[model samples]
Target: MDVVIKDRGNIKWTAIMLPEHVAAVKQEIINLEKVNQPLLDEDRLSEIEMLIYEAMEYNLQLEFKLFKKGYIESIIGSTHFIDYIKKEFRIKDKNELTHKIPFQKIVDVQKV
Candidate 1:
């Protein structure tokens, strides 16, 4: 008999699970993710979008709190141009390099 030790930290044994079991595990993981996700509803998304639009229109510098790969990041810049098709903003930072900030990544915005 082969003795196999499974480590709780890794899921290597999941490879031997029944197809149905593997699907159930995947679904459970997805459901668990929803419980901890940040609440950003349509209204809030629209509000953030509007704020960016206003800043771009006035060529005003602004600050943002946004999520990047599950970490919060701070950015301050003026909206140099908007790429509507790409749904991102090209910002002119203090250093003068253009930065692309995805619309969906923005969590909070304020005028600088």
Candidate 2:
């Protein structure tokens, strides 16, 4: 036997929200109003591509400042691949895990 109570009080709804529902709501908020990722222009994308390609060809370390989730984050790694068509920067982190990161909101680039 199971019993489910509803329509009890306004504040009680928070207790009923499942983890998946909460995550969805948070993602919606980020997509609609919270995040501040600026769109990178074509020129800037090309410049960044050059930097990534140079790093890839020379086995050099590169660092990038990316805008995401209402703030900027920096990642330092060697590029595994730059998917220009998909606009994803596939990089190998220190743990040797390759991550496909969104590169459309790059704020700064530096080679280390």
Candidate lDDT (C-alpha), each: 0.79, 0.79
Query: Which parts of model 2 are misplaced by more than 4 Å?
Result: 1-35, 39-42
- Per-candidate TM equals 0.59, 0.58
Error of 1 at 77 (Å): 0.4
Please write out the lDDT profile of model 2 over residues 1-112, one tens digit for every residue.
8998666663566578987987887778666754567777788778887888899999888887888767778888899887879988888878887877876667777888
lDDT of 1 by residue, 39-100 (tens): 68998888877887898888888887777655568889988888889998888889998889
Evaluated with TM-score, which candidate comes out highest? 1
Candidate 1 clashing pairs?
none
Backbone clash pairs for candidate 2 read: none
Stretches of candidate 1 above 4 Å error? 1-37
